[model samples]
Target: MTTAVDTRQVRDLAVAALAWVSAHRGDFALGADALTADGPVDLTWKPLGELAQTCVSVRRCTPPSDPLHACASDLLDFAWQQTGRGELFLRLQRTEPFATYPLEVYSVFAGAGLRHTGYEVAAGAVARSRGWRLTEHEPTRRLGLLNAERRSGIHRPERFAQALGRTWLGGLPEPWTFERTSGYALTHVVFHLTDWGRTAQDVPAELAAYLTDWLPPWLDTCLDAGMWDLACELLIVAASLPQPIDAATLQDPWRRIARVQHASGALPLMASDPARTHEADPEPSFVHGYHSTLMLAFAAALTQGVPV
Candidate 1:
């Protein structure tokens, strides 16, 4: 017989994780050189965008009565204000008309109803340009861009199915061939297809079936390896499946993550030893813990029956 997962403990984990993010919201600020031509958009902009994206997921998954919903809303407000209520996005789009990062980042806020008409108009114009249309991206990234376009009210000429077909996951590669890189890629393919689990039914039937069959073992391996960050993501993917895996099956995995999570709610990139539960670090690096912590909260929120 399977033991039931502790619902209260899962909710507490989500609460603590969001608390950590709120305390470190200042760290998500862009550097002074962020707006420059040679800006480190990947470093500065990507983190902030991911923050907003994850906040959106949290907010969407939790009910208004839930503290997590309020926490996520606050974070989204902070992220939008950081972009100067979208003024910075308009400027970045103007300066780099062909750049896709600005639009992609802006799309997260826009989808949450924190829009800037000026940025929208500018992005729309750029979307119609030949240069923008011809810009190249890796298949997974291309899927994200197309989804961003659709979110921001821009035209999406490419069919989602066509985009999916171009991805490694869409091809339904051999399960045995799964590795670190492919693992991340396939998770994203599912995320982009389902809008971070808001629409789990959006996942193709075949893909959902494949994940249902293989995800449990993969999640087990990740937890066993103490790959906390990737394991959190896989947890989210598990919750996103059409027929989500039994909560009883996840009791052990959740307990494993809880044991490694710092008192402040940060998670290291990986545990030092999978065989032993290590003490939480007194001071964890923000760079190492941020993504994993956010993913943990997101997964926890999804576990509360947020995803349809």
Candidate 2:
């Protein structure tokens, strides 16, 4: 007999998580080598993109009166500035014209009404080439490129549905086959399909039905394993469906997550992890913690209703 999740608790969790992210914004800054092809993109660009993307969801969902709205807006502004007002993206585009990452990162800002005409013109020219259209990517990667193109207003010949069909989730694979990597892949599949939950209706009926059937057990598995990041992502998937799972069904996971969340709103990568080192080893903490925290905020925002 589960109870409904407290709306106030959800809001409070989001507030605290955003507070943590805000305090650690500096950790997301790019290193001097960030522009080089061999730079540690996972640490620098990836986290910043995730931060900006989650902030976009927060601002989109929360009302101006909500504290989250202001906090997320500030963070989004900071993230944009970190990219040197989109100049970094332009530079990356020039150096790695065929790379999909910069375009994908830029698309998040683009969707939020941030634009860099110079980047777009250059990206557009490259994207229109036969090589760009013909390049092969993994199913999930292909979906990402397609979504980035859609968000950035870059026309591509590929259809989203066609690309989606090639994905693991699109195949509607056996539910028992779910694993760590597949879990992330499927969540991303949903993320792309629904535009990070902004357009839940975009989820095809069959895929939504598949998620509705399997997501509860998957959520339980992640939480039971103390995989906070994956659990939060599953929650986002749950909320992104056309008809979201019941709040009651989510009570236990929410309670477990709340218990582990620090007073400052940061969460560990997994259960009973090391004591946080804000000074000595902030990178590990920031890289692992930010995604889960941002996911929590995004899930909460979706539950609060983003007005479509």
Candidate 3:
């Protein structure tokens, strides 16, 4: 029942989303001293990381001549200037349970920002090294660590490959399910294995086989549940597989997502449903739509192959 993705529609949605972020860049900014409090720091990290991911993906899909290219570049520069200090690490160290799962989460996106922006942060490097040292004690975070390294372009292939070899993906808790956190983790593993779709040939045969068999059902389950963010991540996984998945299978989800995007370019966390509420609070927080919007941008860039 699925149809081919309308490439024009995808591009249009991406353009709108980028324009929204550009216009609201001020709201998304992480002030130099913004990490002074726990609530503020956590809020700042989420949107900043999301925007950085979008910027990187947008850059991949377009040429320098594209209008979005300058916006993405400028935004990354501003983000780097804001958080490149040791503040992120300082905040992490003071956080509860010293080596918590949140540290791994922050590392994954922060590293992605660095890798995509090509901005060098000596402080970030120190923080990542510190985080890596901490993660050695948490086996549950192995996949997270691998994702951070790969996305940040700081990976050790032999070590990472060995880690992947030892992992029993099927044995992991609800390994391939559509639950948000764990599901994202699973997709991140596939992404790292494939080098974010840049080197599909590098995907391990076992993992690729597993995804080949399971991804379709998983994608269906996520869409059925209206888990758009996770669905987008799954789309990236499907696209990165060594043998391409049929584009038609992904078209429906893409169109559904585009239809739900607000006029301001922000894609909602979920599609329209009378039971769901979609308005921002009195003080509009950028975090509300950050993930879905970023995911849409990433998906569009990946699908539209960058101009040569």
Query: Per-residue lDDT of 20-83 in model 3, one digit per residue for the tens?
Result: 7777778777665554444564566667766765676567557889876777777766665555
Instruction: Note the Cα lDDT for every prediction shown.
Output: 0.85, 0.85, 0.61
Error of 3 at 25 (Å): 1.4
Tens digits of per-residue lDDT, candidate 2, 1-308, equal 12377777877888888999999989888787779987888888999999999999998888888789999999999999989999998899878889889999999999999999999999999999998988889999999888998899998778988998899999999999999899999999999998998999999999999998999999988877778788889988888888887777888777777777778788766665324222112223776688888888888777766322
Which of the two candidates, 1 or 2, achieves a greater TM-score against the reference?
1
TM-score for each of the candidates = 0.94, 0.93, 0.73
Pick by lDDT: 1 or 3, better one: 1
- Runs with alpha carbons beyond 4 Å of true place in candidate 1: 1-3, 274-283
lDDT of 3 at 18: 75
**How many pairs collide in each candidate, listed in order?**
0, 0, 0
Highest TM-score model number: 1
What clash pairs does model 2 have?
A: none
Q: Residue 9 lDDT in model 1?
A: 83
